[model samples]
Target: MTVRTDLLIVGAGPTGLTLGIDLARRGVDALVVERADGLFPGSRGKGIQPRTMEVFDDLGVLDAIRAAGGSYPVGMIWQDGKRVGEHRMFDPAEVTEDSPHAEPWMVPQWRTQEILFGRLEELGGQVAFGREVVGLTQDEDGVTVRFPAGESVRARYVVAADGGRSAVRRAVGIGMTGETVDPSPMLVADVRIAGLDRDNWHIFPPHGEGDGFLAVCPLAGTEDFQVVARFPEGASVDVSLEGIRKVVAARSHLAPDDVTEVRWASGFRPRAALADRFRDGRVFLAGDAAHVHSPAGGQGLNTSVQDAYNLGWKLGAVLRDGAAAGLLDTYEEERRHVAADMLGLSTSVHRGEVRRGEATCQLGLGYRESSLTKETRATPGAVRAGDRAPDGNLDGVRLFDAFRGPHWTVVAVGVEAPVVPEAVRVVRGRALESYGCGVFLVRPDGYVGWAGDQTAGGLGYLGRFGGR
Candidate 1:
């Protein structure tokens, strides 16, 4: 059986699902396929960063996610059974007042997906489970996709979100170039504790004969916590409850019997790798399909969500109104930098004794190299025209209305302001001092297109992105 659609997305994970929802909301029909029968129920990738929260807010799913999960204000780093340092997450609510997004929230990946999948359904899109894309062929006009169920789909564009071992990427002959970390098998378990400490994330650095470290983080709405033990090379210990109990007892004074119940457990290795290219003609890749890195910073899920968000609006614009195909190229140019930077940072976090900082994981990224960036001469750390525009209020208007589509937002401050046409949503406020003023153009995906003083070629900057 052969089907047709405007876009065919391979994989039904968070990235693919979010892409489908974004396209559907824009009235651009998309078909998503997944090999799994249903959502993966696991404790994988539980931290949702601020940028991701803003993306979710734009998609109108933030409220659902918040309702599903709560927040933790602090993340701690420990060494030798003592607290070394602590970093508090920038409050998403406070940050969003001046940002495109409010603040980052902590939630399980499954809960985040549940809300996103619900939103996709509300947008009249559905995932075709138990279907996998086995092969793909793309030309200038479109892509022809073959599935394992003896089915085929012809789409104007194809997205590979099938994960690190992506079949679509292989079929298209894209090389995923990078180094894999040595297989240091780590034991991960989710369990309930009767008398163990539960105040904050617990870290036990290598002590005595143990090889690596043990980390404990709280699981919201439950009395249990997620425990991660990085075993030293050649360390022999089973991942069973008795094994965990013995290890905990050996490292800390905690007893094995203190662990009342074990909810889940697994052992896996982490790696850092990225695709050499993100696009090949009509086919593109997103999420883990393009890059894979250590979970040390909890950035895998957040980065993947951002990847889909960036591609969603661009692809929707192209499919619906014939927006420039050049926009699609920016995905690779922009996200690959992010992935490379992530790989570097994760490598550091993995080896060094220092705990990763939230700023390194969240705030420091900027898409200045993109053609969409306007103010080129700005210094580093300065809010340039093309960076991720910070969130703040303009007059009384909020920057992003998650329930509705984002508009070309113009932030005009100062006594002498350029007259922006009615086609743009202009907000006049003094809060622009922290972010910027003159004129700021925001892409539909909530990225800054251009920002500069009113006299800094605001008109030219606006014209670049189709603002009249």
Candidate 2:
């Protein structure tokens, strides 16, 4: 069967599903296609950062996400079968009004995908499973893709959320440049253990020369623990149930019988790579397809979800809101830089050059350097153009609630807002501590697109995105 959609998402992971939800809520005709018939089942990429939490809140999935996950547990270091001490994975930070989610949350990647898939279905969206793209052709107007199972699709825009080895990316001929963060191959598996306590993430350091460390983190909201172990470069590693048992027995004091079962297993080499470009013709790359990160800082899935969040609105604007197509160009300009920065951060965390701290949370990321950001005010306040619009309660209204939905927002903080079209949401309040006293325009993605001392220049920024 031949299907038609406004946006064709080539993956069913967090990236494609998030984009599906966003575009579906925006009233865009979109479809998510997955090569696999069911959601990915594993605990890989289990860390959801603070910024990603905010994004989920806006997407109406926060309640489900919070209910499905828990905060990261403290690390428990062990040596010679004895508990040495307790270790903190992240520095403590108080959750403030402006930044509500202060630390990373631990949810299995499979659970995250399940929650997102549910949200997508709740939005009346459809995902085509077992539909693998074998060919892609693009013209001046739209993209046409074909699969081997007698299925084809025509989409106005095609998003390659397919993953690191993206079929669509390779079909489109986009090049990637990157380096191997670690030469040592790693084995990650979800296993059931009998003797381990779920209260802490158990860590077992290398005992002898050429040995690698092992970490068993209890999966929040689940009975399983994710086991991660590294082997010397080129050493043979096993992922079988008995193999995992042997590793646990050798690395820790636990006997092979302690490993109850192995649910899923996989082996990989850590890599950090980014696509040479984010956009080509009518095709765009998002998530792991665009930027592959070492699983060090838990940025891979979070960054990919944010990429969909960033592009969803722009595509909706141009397709449904009558905005100029030039708005689409900024997607690459803004997201590419962010992806590059995140690639470096992930590599740093992998090498132990940087700790998983404030940067890894991703709440401070912004697009100040993008051409779309306009800081007209001569003197900037606490908030500036291209900064994340901090959340706060002011004048009996929640700023995030005002900025919710698929609409732009013009916030008048101790200033008068200019006359705006009904398409733009108007929020007025007293001086906010987080945003300060200025006229701020928040994009559909929740970042400040424009800021000024008064309403005179605020309207201009809205016009660029078809808000005025």
Candidate 3:
């Protein structure tokens, strides 16, 4: 049988689910297919950076995410079965009107996917489990994906969110350029344990020159702890229950039996890689398929989610809002640069050259150099075009509330509002300190697409993307 859709998203992990949610909310017909029968069952990629929290807020899942997770605890160092010292997980940042969510929130990867999946289903999105893309052929008009069961899916566009070892990426023949961030293989597991207090993240440093460090962090909102242990270079990691218990007993004061339940386990060597290209004809790579991080600095999942956020609106505009096809080209033009920067940041954090502070939070990320951005103001204010539209109050209305949904917004801050397309939402009021005195055209994804001192420049910029 042949199924058809405007967009076919491979892998129902955070990226595909997020793209599905965004497209569904825009009334765009998109399908998300995954090889696995269900969501990823692990606590990996648990750090939800403050910027991602804003993305979740726009997607309408922030409340659920905040409810399901808690703040990261202080790190408690252990040596010779005794407490040594304390370590802060992230650099402190104050919550401001513009940046409300200042720190990283901890929720297991599985729960985040579940919440996204739930939101997708609620928005009338569809996910076909067990549909693996074994082969793919793309024409000028659309791409046809083949499955092992002889089923075929034809889509105007296809996205690969399948992961670092992406089948669709291979089918498209995209090459990944990367380096091993660390030679030591690491083991990660989600386990239920006794004898450990949940107040702090437990850390056990390497005992000797040849030994490796181990860390056990309480997975918030669940009775489980995420254990990460490193092995000496060239040493194989053991992921079995007994293997984990042995490590825990040797590294910490807890006994082997203290690890009462081993929920899941996996092993990997820390590596950083990025696809040579984000797009290949009608097929585009996203998430781990596009760029694989070291899992340090908590950038992989957050960057992946933002990829979906970046591509979703462009897809919706082309398919639903009569946008020019050239608008889609900006996806690679914009995201490729961001991915390269994030890859560097992840590697830096893994090597301890960069701290997990303002940089890792991702609020500073933007597309100032993108072709889509129009900065007509000669002397720009603190907030400029291509910067993220910060959350704040304008005339007693929360800016985020006005920016919510699948529509563009015009924030006229102490300026005459331009005549925009009837579809665009406009808010006129005194200049917000975060926005400054200008006419800001906010994209549906919450970035300032165009900013100018007057209305003429802003109106023309919008006309190119159906904003007129």
Residue ranges of candidate 2 with Cα displaced over 4 Å: none
lDDT of 1 at 411: 58
| Candidate whose lDDT is highest | 3
Candidate 2: tens digits of C-alpha lDDT, residues 1-468: 878888899999999999999999989999999999889999899999999999999999999999999988899999998999999999788899888899999999999999999999999998989999999999998999999977899999999999999999999999999999999999999999989899999999999999999999999999999999999999877999999999999999899999999999999999999999999999999999999999999999999999999999999988888889999999999999999999999999999999999999998899999999989888898889999998998788888888878998888888877789898888898778877788888999999998888888677667767672
Candidate 1 lDDT over 1-468, as tens digits, reads 889999999988888998988888878879988888987666677777777777777788877877776666365666544578874433224433555433445676666777788899988999999887777787878899987767899999999999999999999999987775646778778877765455667766676664777777777645668888878776654778888887776665467787777777777777889898999998899999998978766778888888888888778656765557787888888888887887777666776644545554465577877866776334422466666666655676655541236346665555255676565666666745566445566677666677666546776766544452
Poorest lDDT segment (10 consecutive residues) of candidate 1:
87-96
Candidate 2 clashing pairs? none
Model 1 regions lying over 4 Å from their true place: 73-104, 234-263, 376-382, 401-406, 415-424, 429-431, 452-468
Summed backbone clashes in each candidate are 13, 0, 0
lDDT per model, in order? Answer: 0.73, 0.92, 0.93
Rank by lDDT (best first): 3, 2, 1
Report the poorest 10 consecutive residues by lDDT, candidate 3: 459-468
Per-residue accuracy of model 3 over 1-468 as CA lDDT, tens digit each: 999999999999999999999999999989999999989999999999999999999999999999999999999999998998999989999999889999999999999999999999999998999988899999999999999999999999999999999999999899999999999999999999999899999999989888889999999999999999999899888889999999999888899999999999999999999899999998989999999999999999999999999999999999988889889999999998899899999999999999999999999999899999989988899999999999899998888899888889999999899887788999989868877898999999999999988888777777777662
